[model samples]
Target: MTSSPEPTYTWGTTSEINSFIRHLNKSHRILALCGAGLSAPSGIPTFKGSGSYWKNHKAAALSHPETFEANPGLVWSYFAERRRLALCAEPNKAPRALAQVARKRKGFVCLTQNVDGLSQRAGHPKERLFELHGSLMDIKCSNKECDYIDKENFAEPICPALAGDPEQPSSFSFSAKRTFTTQRRDATLSTKPSRTNAHEEYKYKREPNPLEALLESLSPTITPEMRQVVIPESELPHCPKCDSLLRPGVVWFGEALSKPMFDEINAWIEKEKKLDLMLVIGTMAEVYPAARFVHLAKEKGARVAIINLDAEHTGGIGLGKNDWMFGGDVEEVLEVLFEGVLLNG
Candidate 1:
């Protein structure tokens, strides 16, 4: 087979990528698989890249059932904070370009690993785009028994325990002077309690000072009455009949990808009319099953183009043979490609 000519522009430059866009316009079916890097320019940090925020914490601890079993409240809190962060971030230019391409093209599908829902926000047709990792904007009941899946604004009220008890209060109050430190690996932050019970005595020490006096000296920073929210095994949300705690619907580490989701993707790929080209943007191309799609597309004789900051062309997929690998910021590279070739065409 004759190899495609190598385009001669530096990655992320407009000059060379425009040539590539011209190449893409000839194809009818285009499939794009996006990853965290695509959203980096929109202020969303890449999940596993250099300077990624998740580098410090153990990802397993946050997503595994074992960790949630040990402390569901803690896990929920962590995810809630993540939801807040995602809400604040906006979709970048890459998604906008993908959306534009999808609108103009007859057969375009986008499969994304990001949970930020930016692709949809960028005006991509929801029917044509698939979120492989699920979404951060959605919330489901922690009780397996309850079918309480609902759309939530980032600032929803926590379960009562998380909010603390209003009726019965504890003598031991939280100190305002407490400071928190976030883990470097994941988005988890640890707050150190100021007071620890030195004596094994379960009872509060009788220091004869009135509660009012204690309250007066305390800094306004501390909310003494606040109780830590903990999801107990006994109270785990469950199916009404089965009584199971409904857990977060996210795909966790070491867990198999959802079968139905896999089926949908496979069906799309298996259509009699094979794709004309496959565009992989912003991914390291390391993860499973998703990575296999590119290989399958290439096997079926579809041209492949990869755009990423740090990507490797493993599996002997030669770049010269109807394949191009461009490395750099996805947004900038796409801007150049779209403006110079796609839009102009």
Candidate 2:
């Protein structure tokens, strides 16, 4: 397909962007593919790059199946912290503007790799979005037989061992300091918190002074039960029928992308035939499947615009002369773009 003539705009000036907005408004269908960078202005952390917080840990630790299998309690704690962070963050102007645009237009779809759920909070229609990474607010049992899932506040007492133990209560003491190390149970299968380190390991031993103070600070009000304790995976909730521990339902590294989600996104792209424009904001565009969406849109002859603090040497394959590549802080650039062009147009 032939590319459309590049529209002229004074990038930093409102008039330039208003021209683009006029073009956008004329299109019948538009789709947005967002990444972690889109949420960074709202204070969510990016997964990879120089300033990322996950530098010490592998990406899989937060979303990998093996990590969950080895220590469901530890995994849940990680997500609980993320949930807390996300809840405190407010969606910035970009998502809000996109939502406004989406509401006014027909056939708009947003596919986001972020689990923060900010898009929904920003008033984007639920049916128009596909949260490909899964949501941090969702919890489910690891036991396949149980099929138990619930929408509980992540800040609530979350421990695998405490699942069925009414006598056992939830506490936040372990949420930040909790750590898990792998130990082989046997040749075939392994259990987390293996007998080797199950509460008796030298490292697991609480220091006499600080540990006591920590325990004291954990007021019983933090949990429903009066007792303040951190349950190891050994004490996590077990499947009532099969006696298996429950775990959070996050998509981790090395795991296949959720089949149902992939299918849904693919179906949307197929039905659209061609996207009018693609706004790639604040992402490095390195990851698979999610990054592949940009290629698909370009293949179908969509105009692509990239906005990021970092630069891509290739300018993304298939981006034409008409497409714009604006490099710098996304929020600042977007403020300029929207105020200059979109809002006025």
**Candidate number with greatest lDDT:** 1
Candidate 2 lDDT score relative to the true structure? 0.57
lDDT string for model 2 (274-323, tens) is: 77877777665556667888888787777877765443332334557777
Give me the runs in candidate 2 sitting further than 4 Å from their true place: 1-19, 50-56, 151-231, 234-243, 313-318, 336-345
Each prediction's RMSD over C-alphas, in Å, is 17.3, 17.1
Please report, in order, the local distance difference test score of every candidate based on alpha carbons.
0.58, 0.57
Model 1: per-residue Cα lDDT over 1-345, one tens digit each: 999854333342333355566677777777888876687666554433122112133333455555565566655655654555566667778899899888877578898988787898899988788888777765566554466654433443334433433374321111110100111112111332112321121121111212232243233221221123445655543434445555555655545676888788778888856678888887755566777778777766778788765433333344555466665557767876667434554
Give the Å shift of residue 74 in candidate 1: 1.8
Model 1's TM-score against the true structure: 0.68
The superposed Cα distance between candidate 2 and the true structure at residue 260, in angstroms, equals: 2.3
